[model samples]
Target chain A: MTPVSESLRAAAGTQRVPVFRARGVSKVYDMGEVKVHALKAVDLDLFQGELLVLLGASGSGKSTLLNILGGLDVPTSGTVVYRDHDLSAADERELTRYRREHVGFVFQFYNLIPSLTARENVELVTDIARAPMPATQALDLVGLADRMDHFPAQLSGGEQQRVAIARAVAKRPDVLLCDEPTGALDLETGKRVLAVLEQVNREVGTTIAIITHNAAIGALGDRVIRMSSGVIVEHVRNERRASLDEIQW
Target chain B: MRALNRKLLRDAWKHRGQMLSIAAVVSVGIMTVLTMRGAYESLSSSQAQYYRDTRFPDVWVRLERAPESLRGRIAAIPGVSAVNTRVTLVATLDVPSVDVPALGYFVSVTDDRGATLSDLHLSAGRFVSPRRRDEVVVSDKFAIANAFVPGDTLRAVINGRQRDLQIVGTAISPEYTYAVPPGAIYPDDQRFGIVWMHRDALGPAYDMAGAFNEVVLTLSPRADTARVVAQLDRLLEPYGGLGAYTRMDQPSHFILAGELNQVRSMGTMIPAVFLTVAAFLLNIVLGRMIATQRTEVAVLKAFGYSDLEVGRHYLQFALVAVLLGALIGIAMGSWLGQSMVGLYGEFFTFPTLRYEFSWILAVLAVGVSALAAAAGALGAVRRAVALPPAEAMRPEPPTSFRPGVFERLGLGRLLPVAGRLILRNVERTPCAASPRPSASAFRSRSWSSGCSCSTACNT
Candidate 1:
């Protein structure tokens, strides 16, 4: 068991193991006249029930690495294994299955289907999940239980983002990956959104990884990895993770 | 409902205007298909039923005159079931208030027999009595056109003698259902008519006593109509046969069949054009919509939806519009078809005419429409699914704009800010909407006014 999974077992009162192992993963985008390397031989392990923040500036390959781990993309020349399944060797169908069963993602823009109400959006995932929480329960977890009937257009920015979070977690996947979830929000709204994330991590024991350029947000994570120019520059383990409300941007 | 399906409903409702427009185009195509298909089926069936009920002749021949004794010999020919000999003559009609003389065909009516080939359907009044030599039964269409009913008087110059003929009845006959003036392809009932008179009256009028000018023959069941026609032609050759022809060669049936052929081809051709245009329009609109939803597509993918699921969501949107259009088309076509049948009844004189719905045609229409919509959506759906989630979620790269050669010209410096913006926009994006007004004169005047205003501002 990895250290992060060990910590997750402690949090969940059960034995947990590493969920993802990426080895020397690299991604190259060929632009006809030029080849742009997005990820350069990166290796990483994601365990159960830990909130890991990847901190980087724009063009730092942080988002690309998160995508590879989430099965939304494939590594050009390296292997990524999710539990016992080797992602690099998997076809498109298998990769899609892995994402469906094991991963949830949140984006900078809430990406809630505009036509669907909050509860319906959450129900989208729950309907397809093998074992999922009720759509109502997921909304309650995000503190938007009363607003479940509202459409994304009718809700405020923070409320819509919370609905997106509820939608992502409703499936009760093994891991939750969020990319710049607070990038579009004000300071107060961002803090409230982060607080929800903290609560979900503590309650569900779901291994969570968030990508952001803001260093202040990293204080809420159990581990922080910083990237620059398609490579990791620093990784730090937080001895004590702070509550979101205690930090000021 | 499934969550995805619920999303589809709401999405369609939100864009109801666009959805309805596409559906309207599709409906036009389906409407054309239904109207033509229904008309074709109804007309063909009605014609067959009319021919059968009237016992229409298989062959007809006309000559100067033939003795009545030849009727038995003609009937004795192989496959000949029945024969009728009549005196036929054309006369000039003089109706009141009509300056031009209308042509009238005065046919000799046989004795009142229960079973006679080419029987007339009396629509109004009684048939003329054999004793009343001056009484006549007129074609219903001609009577209707001239506003003449039973007991009306018609003056006809028969064999150089102008005599008053009393109309006793108005009737329709399968032989002359679609009558035309000689040398014309279409009927002009106001200018031409058919009048049936007694044989005793017509025979002396034409100065042909105990003789006939025309013979019509009916063949036995399952007999060859062509072979009988050929034998009749050979037998009557010595007595001025003129020609013996089958029903297919008869002017009324021949012209009607030609028109029906044109309609059938149009049923295929016109709908094809409408459907093709509709499909092309759907493709363009759906492509633009999918392009705008790239980020949403990425988000769906990130939510663990397979590419196929995302594609299916968009396809369902198109199919829903198609189904709605088809239902509207079917309703509209059914109503239009009934109206068309009524119009044809007045023109074709069919005893029974009704719109016939064809299930094969309905199925074909729906199948083609579904195929068209699917084809229209294929390109857009593929693009939506092929997008990489990571790339699609990222903001688009900024577009860089630079000055063009037009901006460097000395005269261009005198242009106003609006003019400069137009020049730069044109340079920045060649495909941008045109800045010029669609009205050509207004576009020239606006350009001149802008130049004058810009020079004044610079001064």
Candidate 2:
């Protein structure tokens, strides 16, 4: 194990190996007359192969923490170490390298390129990935095998989100960060999208972090962290995680 | 193909309307450039070749009369290579087929039909036979205008005597490529013609048995034409010399050169305006596209595609449009150039006029157009590459809407709801309304200028 994982394991009082260890991370947006503190001195850890949920209401900084963890952003103060890489000190190029090699992200909106078909969307990730599954196989894992030839415009909202998920995981990344992946879908479609995410984590043994405002969806994660105003208010472990079908809004 | 390229192709297809409109504008710009340049090249090359074949004079002088023996002294001037002196006279013609009296410029050819400066390309029949007083060759344009052919007879009153001259041939000369009657700005072939007669016959008829009134000569390469003109004027002054001048002062050559300059300036100015409008349209379209594809850019970056890759994807859209325009422009330009040169053949007679397609010109057109398009696309591509992945995926903040300038000026209450809404919309989306007004203004100005030019041409 690396020194970061060892130290994180000792701090957590458990044998779990952390893929990310962020200490007192903060983010400030300078909106001219006022400074908006999106994230404040919040220390956190994301363990390897564990499905984690970051639950909070709107403006609670849950998405900001997830962004910092995914290397899409850097903290204003404090350090963020992913494995042995110091993401806090990384430049734009180094951060891009980190994202390409290890991190995968899914936004609330599917963000699939409308001009590309489902399979081609997945192939975008596979094209530059060091080691990747075939785009067809990734689509199949997302239950979009039959719709692989369909463009995003032709697919339903939920199906497009599934394609987004397929694109993220095709690279076989070390961790998957999803921010409200089902936020735009209907109840039935949302459940179907969540089941795909659950299946990927269960089958691939990939670490996952999901940020959402829905508290009921917390039962699907191995651990949960509740945030309020830019700081972590509660952190809990679920003894037995519920299946996707059992979770409700 | 890579997925990004596939996306580029499909996105272009989806927006084919805007893309093709931009391409059409680009094509017009390239076509104008190519057409003007091609026509200019055709006129210049044919003029040069005609001048070379005819041994057109470098200097010309006219006087009351100079003894034929003086040709030897004029030829002895420094830098003078070859000289030809002949008696030239103008006479009134009474053609049987024409009601009005025609003007005839009578030039003397050698009795033996030997080569001379300002030679003619024969179109039909033959040159005047040795010492035949009545046999003459007429200009091709005058011959066509009057429907005259070989063996036709026309009466000319030369030096108070009327003589029936028989037409032996018809020809075109480089010296009179843009021939206009004396004191006339435009050619009137029906009222004027050139009549070439044997020197033995024409000299004595004009009371110059062994004398000549006009002199034309060629100069050696690297010779000072001004110095030679000065020296020739001094020698001929005692023989009633009027003046001596080089080809630059020759009316026909001067007019032809001026026309060519017009073509060159048209090639430069018109295309510049067209291309500026094309670039403006491309910038507006691509900017809107990038704005709408904010999330797509974010997703691409978030999925490990580099900023350069994303930027390239958008630039390819512009390249495809420009290439399509270049192909259309090349085809249209070549055809239009051929037609334009053919039109020149009517006014300025050349042995042959051909529009040759230049690969260098085609390459330059494509290069310039691509450069303009890339410049137009630069701002939008930079915006896409600079967007932070995290922030772009989120919805943009709501714009703070307030009363527009018109509303603040107390004009809001006087306007209808629809008019007020439009004002607000224009204020909110300033870019949408910006280029159109300027483009329309430019178009109207171009139209008015074009109308004025056509009216001037008609008069």
Candidate 3:
């Protein structure tokens, strides 16, 4: 796995040196006659194995930043350097390789194929991944081993989301991006989902960045970013990330 | 590739209605094209039979009178075989209560022999013998149509004078080529009647047989028809001649232009309609399926599948639909062609109308239908396979409806249920006609799957 580098050892829980460094990142949307600045003059850095939470309201550019970091969109003007490689300036094939070797993503709705069983859904990813564990073992890591053969329809909403987590993490990527992972679920289900995310962080030591507006979620992250009107208003560093189960609702 | 084909077949089965509609379109087209060919062939063979049975003479000579020297010269012509002179005139038959329409009777100077001319059919009784005075024979067509038989009585009008005659036998002339009945545009068997009598007997009693109206000859077996006809016409020119008609002069009523061309023209026009319709249906159905499979395409792309691979998957549908249509069309066209031949046997008198098979039609049908199916899939496949892998992998963002907008005018408070329904509807996709909508989560389907390899792989 390209994710295993000696410098990433310090990123466990907290790291000072930047593993993902950005300088003057900007993403502009040209709408026929009007241009909307989705992201502007953003500068940031992220370290390995640290859980960073992005906080913002709708249109605050939190999702935009996450999309760019996950290789889903290109920046209009910027330099995003992940280790020795420049991501923002890379071509489509290069971005694809970066995503496959270093990044994994989880979205709000789970996005599971309804016709496939939970295990098969995760296996869809692991089969193409390099240096990955078996899909069944990955699902077990997410606490969904017993429901491997159950289809998405047969499982509860929380169980399906957990399968999604297994699918993303099965490749053992260095970076995990979650865009509102628990946004669609109820509080109890959300808590269970958060516990799985926390275990993946502690065990796999993946540098996770979750984009959400839930203030309580910030309590569980090593670093917190507050965004408003396409700009980062505040960046707060926590001395310690509270254990997933220890954080109060 | 074989494994992919097998999977493709299963998916096609899952979407049977759509596939069959495409096929039906092609089958209909092939049937139309084939039917034209069949109907024309049937009519042609039928007309040919009519001509042969009538025994139409190649060269005919008619005159008010001819000298003895001229008759001998004509009979001794290089290509002449045998010759017979006859007096023919229109007459009406008088039954007990039925006065039949005008008919033609010939009074021959002598009984026709190979030494003379005897190309007529004697279906039942004997022909007029030499030196016979009162014996007469009526044609089989007249006897059969009028319920006449051997030894039946018949009356003939000789120059507006009634004369009783014996219907000694029945025979068929060798010069009547039409089943529609001689001198009638439509079929009227009751209108054309023929009888035969000795010229010596008719001339003494009726006094009109001495002046012959026509002279017929049976040509030598090896004679050139056109050359003989020209020589005979020149020899008989002083006797008053009009024209000569050979078997080749006749054109089949069904094939006035060209039998093959007629068949082809009909074959082309009809099936084109159904095939076009089938193509349109395929395009629409496939387009809808691709649109619905948008997310799945992204997932597959994320799994390292090239856009070309994904596009080929969609193209399989077009091939399946079109080939199926072609197969069905071939079967239908063949069956209809045979059935049409049988239908024609009722009025036609051919030995048989042979069934001709054309594989070209089958090829054309399949080719056209496949083209249609492939054309239909273009938009869907293009749209699904065009996106960048990353774009495909991400779920579409939810379209948010502002709660304040719904709350305005106190509508949200009054129609809370409706508002909730609208919100839920917006969240769910507009999935309607797609048969295999995303078909479940991304699972790598492989060839030769079994328990040995599947246990660790199912997840």
Candidate 4:
């Protein structure tokens, strides 16, 4: 048995609830002439308020697994349960509602609307959220309070990524899913972004799952799962997670 | 404002040029509609009211010499409410500093104004008095065209003798509102005019001292005009009568009605072309916008915006463009409409011809433009919402290309790089490159939209 399942069993013995439970999940894409198997029978459990790092090389299905857990896509043949909701059985509309109420996603490229200021971009998600943090407060959490009025074009790449982070967290979602959140930044900037994500998870107690190709980023998480060829090969629990300043590329 | 609405405003401002282009097309369409519609209403209504106020004759009969006693007989006919008898003659007018001899229809008016069936609206001067036998009242359009004023003297060949007539006044008559010479399609005011003369002078000049050459009849409201015309023609047949006809056959009214129909048709046809092009341009622009904004759209979807919300956003953008165009059109159309009324006054004489503003037309224009803009945005908006969030968030795979069908037909090697590039783009967006009439935004709209516009005008 993997260390992740073993930790989960230990967690279950302590009566700690999980945020998500996914079983036998597989995704196949039909490209007309050929079938591409993106995800193969994957079973995973995401515990409440814990930081998880999905570490893998490109095309190893880590992002696919994260996407499925976030309800961004449907599995070809599997069951995914989020809290009391059955994500596998949910239609598009139900999934949209689920995402709006419970999920926050941060992408590699900060897809901030160019026409909008940083503050306004965050307000976009908060306006539709059932429960949300104030946009200014969210920006303050991401250390972008002074740069709220600057448009995406006027900000640096690291600042834009911070704004994207603020926009995602402003909704006060229960689960935060980040897919390569610092893929395009310099070493220092990437470290700064990781620090913000770490701070957000610590302060808000929001469950976080970050998928990344950089193996070093895995040291910051409470649990790290290494994936290869659409399956987890290794899972380890950290007794002491490393701080942002102590880590180097 | 909500964040989404703020984004809408800033995005629209960023693409102001495209939005303004769409608005301009809509403005042109509305302007055409309002201008022609305003002109038609002003002309038809003014003429109808003028004819009613003057109690214009419904039927006219012309003969070589009809005895004055025939007036009583015509008045006694069933449905004939009034009969006006007068002597008429066509004379050649010779004005000073003018090389060509102009045609003049000289009709005698009664000294008693109340008894006249076809009355004149004096515009500038007094009517010709009976004592002033050589005085005349010239048609208003003719006077304006020839630059003649009251007290101007004109020489005319009256009954084979040259006579000098003084222009006492300029008058507008419903009978000569759109005066055209006999057998002429359009009015030539410079070469033809109507001169109202005294009965005592005109009868003697034409050598018909006690006989009338023209008879005008006004019938009851429900009178059969054709039957009355046939009866009058037969009764005056022995007196060398040529024929009798109702107002529908009158050259002035015929030409005026034809002109009004033309205005209506032009209003419908021209705008249809402009609006159709506008719709096509809007579609192309929105389609391009969707193509470029796929990432933003995916982000919006990931942020929990539903497909309906995204669709509404684009539709609202399209509507905003349409609204801008409609405002420009309303201003432009109103100005054009008023100016056209002034222009029409120069050709058609009316007592009260003015620009008539129509609120209904304005409303209709706005409604139609809204519908057109919405329709143009529908396909683009749908495509935007149909983008899956997962695939769209990542970089799209590069478009694949194979050696086209032409290569299989052995024609690929003959094509140059530029030709292949163009063909590849054409294959990617087939509508943009095709020669099919409906696919073209500019050229083919002229014919197809013209047909649609004429139909709209008729309705």
Reference-based TM-score of each model: 0.84, 0.88, 0.57, 0.84
Ranking by DockQ: 2, 1, 4, 3
Task: Please tell me which predicted candidate would have the highest TM-score against the true structure.
Answer: 2
- Measured with C-alpha atoms, the lDDT of residue B426 in candidate 1 is 53
Q: TM-score-based ranking, best first?
A: 2, 4, 1, 3
TM-score of each candidate's B chain against the true B chain: 0.78, 0.86, 0.53, 0.83
lDDT of 1 by residue, B176-258 (tens): 87899888878989879999988888998998779998998788998887788888888888888899988888888886777
Model 2 C-alpha lDDT per residue in residues A1-249, reported as the tens digit of each score: 334334434534476667788887889988766999998788788888889988999999999898888888889998999999999999888888889999888878888888889999998889899999999999999998999999988999999999999999999999999999989998899999889888889999889999888888899988788889998877777878898768877
Between prediction 2 and prediction 3, the one with superior TM-score is: 2
Q: Positional deviation of B255 in candidate 2, in angstroms?
A: 1.6
In model 4, which residue pairs have backbone atoms overlapping below 3 Å? none
Prediction 4 global C-alpha lDDT: 0.84
Which ranges in model 1 have alpha carbons more than 4 Å from their true place?
A1-16, B68-84, B93-101, B109-116, B126-135, B151-157, B160-168, B198-210, B217-232, B246-249, B356-363, B396-459
Predicted model with the maximum DockQ: 2
Q: List the residue pairs that clash in candidate 3.
A: A113-B440, A113-B441, A115-B440, A116-B440, A119-B459, B29-B271, B33-B267, B283-B376
| TM-score of chain A, all candidates | 0.93, 0.94, 0.91, 0.95
**TM-score (C-alpha) between model 3 and the true structure:** 0.57
